[model samples]
Target: MKVNFKLACPLLLAATSAFAGGNNEPTAHRYISERIAQYGEAVERCEKIAASRPLPDESVIEQLRDYSIDDVRIFLITRSSLVSEICEKPELTELAYAIGVLEGADISGTPKEIVQNIKQLVFGEATWGLKKKYLELPVSVQNILKKTDYFDKPFDDIAILNAIENAKKP
Candidate 1:
């Protein structure tokens, strides 16, 4: 039987809430959380600056292009509802969704299929780590790897919003 790997939107929001607002998970289990908190701030700052500025000229765009993987990581972290009630940025939300897919697939497949599975799960997973591993894949498998994760339930945008809203409640 086929299994659906896609997480419900509410579920993803719940998980992000648990990770960010729950009791501190043991440090061994906290790499993603700590990383999220660190990067979330950076993403917020960048968003503020980018929003206030006029369309960046090519030179500024080039400078933004120099943003590192760490920057991407931070964007995903902050976008996950750790810092706000709603993740309004499509780019940030997409990044979080992709990372969640990769983390899920790594738990259930061969390293190669694991790589492909995640690439398929996230819209742009190939442009990152998968480029180096592309040659080892079969043509048929590559086709399978291009599909999106099937969602049995629609994502709950409000669950994340709720989590953010509840963060400071007594």
Candidate 2:
């Protein structure tokens, strides 16, 4: 019993020391919230600059670069004529969102795959359609999709489909 008690004392000490260090690390939600707050501040700064000076697209892009909204960087591109070019392809948004998900630390591959699975949602009728119908729109979504290599070729249609199926499950 004395030997057992001596062994238990070290284990208890180790556990207490571990718990003392555990609370020092920031939680996942806190990290994400901090990143979002930074992005929001950058967006607000971009909006202010745009409001103050009616700059051309190049200038606007440059201004956005001056602020560090790294996550929404593509949206800055999308909002420009670049988007007109980008939306011509169906997959740009899908690929971009996928890449964003992959790059973000908090997001899992499943959620990123889920974002990719919603390809049709991103293209909307404004862009994707039959080639003839697509051309009839101001721009074609296919062109945008092609430009971004949205699916990154060798495609993962099954993975995407499975992701969608899982999402539908209650």
Candidate 3:
């Protein structure tokens, strides 16, 4: 017995169409906002865990790491004023900066401006491994890192503020 091919083609197409893009996919703004909220919640959970002991829980670190490089970059750029808070948390800060360096954030502006932004973005000190990773970044990013004086000394809040103020000069 021969099976009819025409009848099967429409059935196959209908089956695939049902699984196509759906309303479940969020809009760009919604997606960004949701990711940011999740990041904030993860940071808060980590902070609470840290407050109860000398170190934060490993699960929180894993949760934070779940966010993609783009998620971290968007978080940093949108919530820039929270840099100090992010820096104070070593695990979160490291992950955020590492993602930024790895993803090649557009470190534009003059040396001082770039330095000031880096200072704000990375308020906490980077580990030797992270610094090595930063060194391995593209020349454009490396040049920004070098000009930021990241290796000159440990991360100093006062120094960062001073640099930011100095950058505003004509």
Candidate 4:
């Protein structure tokens, strides 16, 4: 018998949720809760992106390099609904986060915290020590770092400091 991986993914996630600990709830309840938490995180990210000031039509057009003014305006207007859509679809979290970064969202955490969170989201919790993995980060993250101003300092210096600061956080 052939197993369908797409159908099995949710079942595997639900089964794993039962052994994740920290609660005595039934397996189904725990699975639901885990999914809800994931959705909540995704929504929070989208909300942060939506809260950023809308880029001027000219700026958006320039930054996008391809989109027309009308398309940019539509994209900006529809951003608010992204939170609800992301919340309902946890699988889109990575794409949502990437878009938020590109859109210059005001992430709630400090730079160090934000980097750590991104690292965890992209590479999993096991990949500690940003210095070691700096070059290994996804292209999206590298692009964001390049776009971010670090007061003329080298990216490595800023990345190291952020890593140290992240380690100091509780």
lDDT of 4 at 147: 41
Better of 3 and 4 by lDDT: 4
Which regions in candidate 2 have their CA more than 4 angstroms from the true location?
A: 1-26, 55-170
TM-score of 4: 0.26
Report RMSD (Å) for each prediction in the order shown: 18.4, 21.7, 22.0, 18.6
| Model 4: worst 10 consecutive residues (lDDT sum) | 150-159
Q: What is the C-alpha lDDT profile of model 3 across 1-170, one tens digit per residue?
A: 00111233234334433333334322322332233334444445543533343212334333323444434333322222233244335544453554355235443323223234333433334333334454454454323323333322222323333333354458
Winner of 1 and 4 under lDDT: 4
User: TM-score, each model?
Assistant: 0.26, 0.25, 0.23, 0.26
Candidate 1 C-alpha lDDT tens digits along 111-141: 2232343335433443333343433434433
lDDT of each: 0.34, 0.33, 0.34, 0.36
Which residue pairs in candidate 2 collide? 88-140, 88-141, 88-142, 88-143, 88-144, 89-141, 89-142, 89-144, 89-145, 90-141
Candidate 2 residues 7-31, lDDT tens each? 4334433343323222312342233
lDDT of model 3 at position 84: 26
Model 4, range 17-102, lDDT digits (tens) per residue?
A: 43533232243334333443464455455445433434333432234333333332333223223223434455455434543453
